[model samples]
Target: MSDQSALQAVIFDWAGTILDHGSRAPMGAFVKAFAAFGVNISIADARGPMGMAKRDHIRMVGQAPAVAASWEQKYGRPFGEADIDALFAAFEPLNVASVRDHADFIPGALETIAQLKARGLRIGATTGYTRPIMEELMPLAAARGYTPEITVCAGDLAAGRPSPLMMWHAMAQMGIWPAHTVVKVDDTLPGIGEGVAAGTWTVGVTLSGNMVGLSAEELAALPEAERSRLRAPAEAAMYAAGADIVIDSVADLPGAIERISASLKAGKRPGYR
Candidate 1:
């Protein structure tokens, strides 16, 4: 690797990228929270803004034309901050409880992280989860042998993913500067966008993320052709959203890092294309 191109750190997203295979927990919490207000949404809608801060995600969902119409019809007014607050109130405890159940590390995630750490790469993390949720999750993830050196959560900053503030925080805390010296790995488009905005090499994880939303068991059970069909849209979405690379899961992350390192050696920074 070119000396200047050597990676100093790798920042990962929490839920779908690390702990929760298929990113199942948050969607359920979002659905339940909305239903509590008598507005129903499909799983796809809930997943649409999956990488945003929980409250922002709820706000985005509520602002959807169809959801907004329903809210107006039901409550005689468009959804607003109050609605988002109420939904988030319902969402937090449910999400906190559900997180433990979904905390199983994605297959090979721990091993992949271990390998990266062994190479002297500082592992930092950025998450849409708030600190309290992360407090619950960190210990669970640690038990599984996968904990980043630094973790920047949603509310820790004034803005979250797609804004780059959280990623910046991670880099600052880890003492990794010059965004090109890092890689941001995540499973959602907004997360990828955050990496792009931060000027870090961005890798999008498919199969085990919001894009495909399949548990390890569920993905393994699919025939090769069907699995490809399911993953195509999500892969394309990530690429379209500016992911420099897309891998099947955290398992494929090492290879991506190798390739990104090569590109860096060739003097290609993120967004170079």
Candidate 2:
């Protein structure tokens, strides 16, 4: 819920926040892209830089120690821009194809957005995906009843997450104001960092995003203790990245927003600073 003295917009990160369940699309594409180059990366390698633009993500994975060693062994040299370019080229098409297959909305995502809108908060989104990938994804998501007022993609600005540029861009395009009046809901450290940088309230989503990395069915299959064991590291990482609040998924979003709105009314704001 919101008011004149409370929160304004709710900016979401696409994959884990609104859809894709476990943020599975890019991971498969990443693994396959690197494997195409004979690099043979694991899921961790594919996920370690989960919130970055795909090329930057590939670059980050290439710099991982195990990946570096593998690259040197295969290419007779270290990974560099040429390798990043090649890997990214391989990644994009596969990512687009993979996204086409995995755009299902996270449970409660549609309902959460509806609740926010009902409370007079606008819905916006940002993503680490490029335009081509988003171009393929938006229609599917829209058909499922998610049409955000604005969606800023990775390459929409000169910089993306952790830079605050995309957040600022989205706010500007949406004609909303005062960074602290907005809430950034995301599941990755870089995404949280962007909110922190932009002075917006940051909400980290644990289970539904890349950090927990399990599909809805898979996560539900885990015992509560095992689930906590898995969620510990991810939740800690979000707090470490300056999240103002953390919740299990968008299902808990209403409570989180209500808390933030109260904080705004109390003249408190994002506290990480």
Candidate 3:
């Protein structure tokens, strides 16, 4: 059998894989929101909740339960609910702005999708953003000539990544019934877990995007061993969470698929290792 028969669809994560540095945009929004509240948080701190629901992630970043106390300790003054609301309101604009303003197609992303489509495979997207946010992004993305055959917005459903609902829904809508016929690509642990839980083949993309914010210069500066150092954590996370294959990036997807096809042919499930 041809390798294509092993995969009927390719599911992708929107922010980081299809667009450039997905998490970085959200991180900037988080930093901006915290700065507005007089609670300074670094981008590094904001990235910790990358794949979570936006509001939930923001709440964690904002230290919601003890917002006043946390702000008092961190900023030398207590912040009121109004202050928190104002900060979150400012951050809210970023949810749509990130995709509309800076959602450039990742290098090789379109070409890869085109190649897969040529092979008769459907393409899909999953994101933590709400449906309205996705509506806002679709036009902007289309304006720039990027599109996915199917798109799953986290808030559109009851649950997000790490939950199989979004993936299952996307597959159903795309007419791909067999979970193993679809391959999910993502840079986050929850996303990988969602794919695995949905029983779809999973490929973890690790290079130059949301999973890591390595600049081209930074990536080039690292030796192969050091590069693996940067990627190992994400790989381990995805593997433990249920990824079938861990790839370096969307650029490495074709090769990764080849490897997955080989393993599947050999009758080895991806996470068995």
Candidate 4:
């Protein structure tokens, strides 16, 4: 769209964008595991680090002594190796089952990606889920017939979202330069920030199954102004991380392209206010 040289690739985020995973699964799993250990945590507490790697998520939860203490006080049992092991074990099966059985491709996702690919744009994806999880889902995705040119998974790399590692790695593997030719789309602040830090054009998508992970009905019930607030966190985070623009959804992407192209055509620096 820009200098032709300025926009050669597009990187997408998985999870909420490509898959329709309801909040019930993760929230229920966390509550059950914490309950077994005699602790209680709200879904809000659990949502704080949605874009972090699995191990980091676990470590973050463990760092809260009060949460661990609540579990110990309730069950008269410590959150020792056994509890941690069981938690991880249960986490995989519960989530994988959903991916294998209940996974719904997001509305318009397949079509939008196909359209972008048809335009000769290189495509890739980055996810906070581990390599094993990705492996389990790949065949399913292949069966569904949507393939990304590259996929950067959690444990495959040393760090996760909020860090530019996964995105930078994906770009390198795809042979795309960050500054002149890439766009990154994501649903979370950390993921958006990662793309911005990598100096790629970053787009933020906001909707029901993200951030707070609200239900569609619940989201729809909210006033339009309240619903608009959903995109603020991503926009602020991306702007701080140096994003050029933040769009509300993937459907708005063509306009985003036009804006960036116009700027580049006008010889402005490749960023926005």
Predictions in order: lDDT: 0.89, 0.90, 0.73, 0.68
Clash number for each model = 0, 0, 1, 1
Model 2 earns a TM-score of 0.97
Kindly provide the TM-score of model 4 when superposed on the true structure, using C-alpha atoms: 0.81
Question: Pairing residues by index, what is the TM-score of model 1?
Answer: 0.97
User: Tens digits of per-residue lDDT for model 2 on 57-106?
Assistant: 88899999999999999999999999899988899999999998889889
Q: Over the stretch 122-151, how does candidate 4's per-residue lDDT look in tens digits?
A: 889998777776787777777887789889
Residues 99-218 of candidate 3: C-alpha lDDT, one tens digit per residue: 565567777777777777777777888887667677877877778766887788867788787789999988889777667667888877777878888988888777756667765556
Ranking under lDDT, best-scoring first? 2, 1, 3, 4
Model 1 worst lDDT window (10 residues): 1-10
Quote the lDDT for 218 in model 1. 90
Model 3 CA lDDT for position 20: 58
- Among residues 3 or more apart in sequence or in different chains, the pairs in candidate 2 whose N, CA or C atoms overlap within 3 Å are none
What are the RMSDs of all candidates, in order? 1.6, 1.8, 3.7, 3.5
Please tell me which model should have the higher TM-score, number 2 or number 4.
2
Model 4 error, position 155 (Å): 0.3
lDDT, candidate 1, 66-144, per-residue tens = 9999999999998999888888889999899999889998888889988998988889999998888888889988886
What are the runs in model 4 whose C-alpha is more than 4 Å off?
A: 1-4, 21-28, 64-86, 216-226, 229-242, 268-271
Ranking by TM-score: 2, 1, 3, 4
The true-versus-predicted C-alpha distance at residue 189 of model 1, in Å, is 0.6
